[model samples]
Target chain A: MNTSVNIAGVCFKNPVTTASGTFGSGKEYSEFFDLGRLGAVTVKGVATTEWKGNNCPRIAETYGGMLNSVGLQNPGVDYFIKNDIPFLRKYDTKIIVNICGHTVSEYCEVTERLSDEDIDLFELNISCPNVSAGGITFGTDAKMAETVVSEVKKYAKKPLIVKLTPNVTDITEIARAVVSGGADAVSLINTLKGMKIDINTRKAFLANKFGGLSGPAVKPVALRMVYEVNKAVDVPIIGMGGISNTEDALEFIMAGATMISVGTANFANPYATVEIVDGIKEYMEKNNIKDLSEIRGIIE
Target chain B: MKKFIFAEVVEIKHMIEDIYDMYVYAPEIAKNAKPGQFAEIYTGLGEAILPRPISFCEIIKEKGLIRFCFRVVGKGTKHFSEMKKGDKLRLLGPLGNGFEIPDAPQKSIVIGGGIGIPPLLELCKHLKGEVHVFLGTREEPILVEDFEKTGAIVHVCTENGCTGYHGYAITLVDELNIPADMIYSCGPKIMLKIVSDWAKKKNIRAQVSMEERMACGIGVCCGCAIKIQKKGEDDWHSLKVCKDGPVFWNDEVIW
Candidate 1:
């Protein structure tokens, strides 16, 4: 398979990257699938400070989906430096670290410290709603989104890709904000804030009361956001949210995304990412396509 | 170890004394599955998504089948108990980490309480030394023949004296009078705690498996985690059972 793709100044072995949080630490996934085959690996959202994250019933199962309120439970920046970073050292794939901060200093602090390490890129994630304040999710407000991108860009020696949320009223405007704020690229459509009611207890299913929703149901909303953002920004886009298979990944690329990430579906099938990667190669081969860039926006 | 799609429904009937006899369709779990390993069996085929995790019991590799004996507790199991011959089940398996069997033990006394006996059955099949198993369930709980087939001397415990020992399994463990070099146990929380505390006092090696709320059956989400201090200080570390372990050295496991 012609499995090579590029983003900004960086290159990936393939276009298949595991979604943050789902590929916890990366070693376990290696048990089922080879980590080196992936284009890049996204670590779980790392917070400036250690967070306990939401309460249990942290995850609840829906008809064909599940909701998780993990509350961004992380081993603080210091711990990540000690524990997580050392483990990623074994993998040869591009390492894109996702960072979350409750305040401005926290974001800068984490990025500044990480600046010393060998990393491929930085994903300024201002989309976690389960946090206190600085997680104001700059992605929701256009101006705030730009400011986060610009601030993190200061210490981030690597290319910056701002991960956006779908809870906003106008997603394109938010995309434009990050682009204007000097973002080298964009990753679209984080999970949507959703809740499920249990008929048994006559209450919310997730103990955290609410969680980010991702799966087939949110695919349309995700696609719409990616389409609008692809048109609004000149930077390359990484699209996500319920992208379970090759057709789904192709849809995002057609809608103007250069690369794609797989979330929620990784749970059902641990090898979902590799399957999508293989599926894409087969799709390209069958279609007689030589370059993935040729179909980046070839929407019929 | 490898993913194979071959699934078959094996009809197993207890030819022993009196017990529930029925056939169940189960996936091959223990071929490459380590001890303390488990699998999820869905009641129906079409996209129910959530499959209940059943600890892998004794395995019969020659027949390409494994067994998991469980008590019918709620809606899911009730549906399973009613399932008879020719019923197909979609199973996702070798799911969680299995028990880490140490190099060797001079002598090990295995303690099983009620439903906990199944996982231990798989572990005992690989033992080299003298192995003594003490099974605790209200005697004649369900399938006595299945327990006996594992080739371990089985001791039964029932509350009303319906079968063997007339008390909790812990009482049976006390009556066993077996010398323990290494002890491994699984079952109810109270039973595990009692064994964990007792083993700690005796300075014996022991490990316990814990069942907590699990969602994805993988480490994607941190749903099932217990606060265990990292073998040192008073500080507690949260470890996910789906990934970190369903098994831990008894002392290292913070109840």
Candidate 2:
């Protein structure tokens, strides 16, 4: 059975890629499972400079999920090129670097710096909800989303995939905006904005007060958004949010996603990605489905 | 590479009200465990999605066993309390950078409060020089005998003065006029802040173990970040408690 799905001109061995920031450049999770088993390893967001992120108490456990305000803490592009790239090169999977920044130039600087790197794709992150300035600014606005994508596309040598945030009024408008600019594909939904309060202390649980929520609770909304964006745009959609099992991945695919990403579930079970991969293969055999294209949008 | 092992529960004992001591037979984990390192204990409950991170109270390398002492705080710890002996627990560990104990024979004062007392036991047992342990709790003190077993001078403090000293653990040190070349501490943020302030005023070096709600006990999830200052840098950088440290020099902390 053919499990491979091509986004843009790049071909992933399978449609299973770890979501950005959840998988730390394939170093920590490599302990439980091999990096090569994945179709692609999407590294955490890298910026033009090192980001200290927010203060402590940055994460809180919510019902059926969790909230985080990690603020995209990373060691910058130089460190990623020196340390993380060499480690990930040892694996056979495709590398999709997620780029984050405070300004449009900051995003282009990272893309330009990584021009000579061995990465297969770039997931331009204008959707991070934790930061105050640039994270959700570009994603929530239609004109801004198109402007950032077009600006980054000029510098990026690899295929550019725009990651969309779900905290917007209308997600399809932003999806169509990015596709109108020069995006090869699109991935959604990047965590919904949420907050948790400590009753005893009468204060917010997270230090940042507001955080991005991800997990099983957000799956239904993600599927609905993916289905709507697929119908609205001509680009391949990478659906993710609260994807825990093979059935969840299948749901995203059936809802018209070309691929699916596993995020918060990795914290619970490190072997979840590989398990879903095997489960997808098992499902194909049972249903006599030859390729993923047959079931890509079967519900429609 | 880090390995997750299924450790069989060898023994479980109720140390005090709501506190439990569980001994697990995990050779691989026990073989490499250090003083301040912790393990992520899987609760096996669907409601509790993330693993609860618990520190190693003791490590008997000869028997290939590790002891974890924890209080039943939430649903996760409650699940651990219900577990029976011989049951296998999926544990991911011996993670995080542990306490650094130099063999220079310096006078060391180890201060721990409530649940924070457990990680210090391993450090006290291994320290070669003069070690004085001061532990404080809200009410009933757990693992006092275990601390005494380490052969260090153990002092206790409770909120109501029902045990050893009155008030906080730092007050005990102040009343005794304890002279120390260094201090090691782990407790609630407020207590640690007091201890850190005392250490700074006295010009004594101190290393503190910090706690945060963690997701991946590994560095992947940037959930457990603690602000820290580098040796020569003036700027504070967010360091992962699970990777950079559960233990950091008191001066490095931004508290």
Candidate 3:
């Protein structure tokens, strides 16, 4: 029988959480199901500077999944900390707020402000492509990744979990760069950027022309990254990509993820958040395992 | 908030040349369904990633069924068109707001252009007396025969001069000069606008259902906001089409 393990001293009741932007503050799903049942809920992405997000046609649907180019259209960090945090604190489950920044200083600034709050953990979103810079830069380079993690880690009084973007050349290098820079844990596989075109109209289906693909379509890629990063890092890994079923969630745990987050699948089925949490418990019971830690990194 | 019960396709009736009548067995929503509310149905083949939003044409709760009429346009509707008897579709419905007809109208003139005809079909059931239905299409193929089952005085306009009263629908309405106290219309946006203008000029009451790029279908996404001219307000205000409408007073819409 295994018990819960500490991640940088932040205690998680369980190991299941919804990915950022996938779960809308947990209130919407609460109408259909109870939110407190889940171990954690990662709210929508929050950027250092306010963003309006992309233009129209920001979303599209494909087989077993959907694409979203919300482009992190969130109220600025100050608003999230001041207004959103109070309501979020009421939930029994832990709050692991996801934060994104355009520049390295912005990351530090947001982290420093968050350091004094009674927050649980801060997940750094170095993964998002910086739109104003005219190129998808931040996640691709090791030096920049290390710089971002190190700076944010300095002011992040809470545990720091770096979310890795999959658009990089080598997933392991980016993971190693952040881990070496004093990050406590890391989340793998933010959305993979993609685009689709309409042949008849000869135009892009999404207004932004590109979106991050999630759901069953990207599960294999997400698994590979989780498996790779689990091998390369000492920190805990929060794995997510196209998780719609119990078997898919188990795959991430077996691949060495300490916890997992569900994204695109929630849209098709709103009750998926707590449903997956129950699923994790069912798996542990069936396997005769007393603790979920026994399953992590056990994959050959 | 209703449970999603199984809805079987009892019969796939080809009403018009390209249009189909997919009769379903949706017990709960149908039993409590109201006119103007729509349902989201999974195209039998899963060709459409999201369920196609179709307004309920007729809800016969005694038989635990509702009917939807759709013209084959894109992949989803075309695949749904191929469905046959005994096919089951997972449907969630009786969604969005419907038109609230006035307490009294001397003569009701219902205008339906192409796909818009199906939604107004159910209105005839709730309304009293004989209604004058003005139906229009580009040609005879898109015109349906089942519309006459309502027993209303029907008029049609075909662009190709192959149908009754050949010409634009507005022309037929203007020429007939029917003394309509209220007009409920649904069609392509342009047609609805013209009908609204005509109703405005004629001093008749009109209600319109608008369509837009919908995401959640229920609401919440904020994707479907239409500008509505509010009474005494200087600026046009935004109203959620999915929740506040799909149905609105004809004059309130900014067009």
lDDT for each candidate structure: 0.74, 0.91, 0.76
Least well predicted 10-residue stretch by lDDT in candidate 1 chain A? A129-138
Q: iRMS values in order, in angstroms?
A: 2.5, 1.3, 3.9
Task: Record all residue pairs in model 2 with backbone atoms less than 3 Å apart, i.e. clashing.
Answer: A215-A242
Distance from true position, residue A93, model 1, in Å? 3.2
The candidate maximizing lDDT is 2
Q: lDDT tens string, model 2, A1-300?
A: 899999988888899999998989988888778889899999999999899888768888877888999999999999999999999989989999999999999999999999789899999999999998898999999999999999999999999999999998899999999999899999999999999999999999998999999989899999999999988998998899999999999999999999899999999888889999999999999999999999887776
Candidate 3 DockQ, CA atoms: 0.20
DockQ of each: 0.33, 0.72, 0.20
| Candidate 2 lDDT, B166-252, residue by residue in tens | 788999887886889989999898888889989998898888999987788899889999889989997988888888989999888
Off by over 4 Å in 3: A1-8, A46-53, A73-91, A100-119, A124-137, A141-158, A180-183, B43-49, B72-79, B82-84, B100-113, B123-134, B141-155, B165-255
Top candidate by DockQ:
2
Q: Please, what are the lDDT tens digits per residue for candidate 3 over residues B88-166?
A: 7777677789877656645888888878888888877676666888888887734345557776678888768896877
The CAPRI quality class of candidate 2 comes to medium
